[model samples]
Target: MGTGTGRMASVLRGACMVGTMVLLAACTRHGHEGYARYRTNCGICHHGGEGMKGEIPPVSGRVDKIASTPEGKQYLMHVLLNGLNGPLQIDGVRYNFSMPPFRAHLSDEEIASILTYLATRGDTRPAPVFRAADVAAERAHPMTTTMVAEERRRLDAIHPLP
Candidate 1:
């Protein structure tokens, strides 16, 4: 009886461990989905948001604040859909890499998820989540990478980043 009870206790402990893992996974599923999308699409350029100095701009620390505003939000969506070219300054560093457009390969939903993933990273402030509808709105008016750069210039003139 004692041996039987010990075996039962060990089995119960294993079951509890499995249950906890499942619950944790379930809780983080949406975030994981966004993260996975980011990995597949944006990670190549951004390097998991760390970014290369004087090359790719880091999105993890900067995106949340920019995403909080209306124009900033639109700019972000446009950048993702159409990509951006030419020199851009972030944190006083100039990066001239031309980002390629993702519209041909990614769906609106995937873009929204990737944006949401980027916006939430390393940010203390509440950032607005991008939705598929927002992507669709931007998709309605497609912009070339050059056009995206022009729009970024206009947006930066209005809302200069600190």
Candidate 2:
């Protein structure tokens, strides 16, 4: 009876150890997935700040500024979903470029995750998850005349006064 009980104890301990390892592996994988998602999506446009036409400003070091403010958050989300054209001013420099909206291309969760990663680590926003519902609602709203106008007005107000 004693030998049998010892064997069971060893087996249980091994199982617990394996479970812990599996959980750890899963967490590591999730982290990698977040990074990969950013690379796959935002990497194309904002990857290290090389704009498509040498007109877009470098966004690599500007993630913090973009993520840290209320208006900044709105602007980033709007640009991501709707794209920006005309002159865009940030941190006193004008990026006289237009970023086409990405509403049809990316889902909110992916945007959220990419923004969260970039803002917190890359841009250093300090608080990254600023516009969760805004992104969601914008994603749902019709991209028509009235809705676009309202959103543009609201976003303009929120954007840092240049």
Candidate 3:
């Protein structure tokens, strides 16, 4: 083969390799197939109604307001791991919802992937990537029941639940 042709072939091969790697990484980290894990578990109550009165707020667009800030993201992650049942105010709307914690139900990596999926597709906020390390650290320092009660009191102080 001519030197020029050989160089061109090498370039094409390199480009093809890069493209394939990118596609594989994307498939592994995102899109429809990426949702299989969450759908099987969290989608149970998060997607819609359960008729439990004050249980399971739809996890779709409702997370937008909270997911916009780091504190909010932390709060959501904490709640998912710790479970919160009481009053929650989102964008001035009160939701008397109770969320069952998933600490025991899911591994840190699994929870992180679920959070990433929700942040990516469900909310308008910037995609929130919950790394397994973050999950582990957060799980290690869980929000105590007392802390949750205090948080509620503080929120109520600011915006009384109706």
Q: What lDDT does each candidate get?
A: 0.84, 0.62, 0.66
Ranking by lDDT: 1, 3, 2
Model 1: how far is 27 from its true place, Å?
A: 6.3
Model 2 Cα lDDT, one tens digit per residue, 15-56: 999999999896566546546876876667666444444455
| List of clashing residue pairs for candidate 2 | 64-123, 82-101, 83-100, 83-101, 84-99
Worst 10 residues of 1 by lDDT: 119-128
Per-candidate clashes, comma-separated: 0, 5, 0
Better of 1 and 3 by lDDT: 1
lDDT (10s digit) by residue, model 1, range 38-108: 99888988987988989988888777778878888898899889988969998788999989898898999
Global fold similarity of model 1 (TM-score): 0.80
Error of 2 at 28 (Å): 5.8
- List the candidates' TM-scores in order: 0.80, 0.59, 0.68
Q: Local error of candidate 2 at 113, Å?
A: 1.1
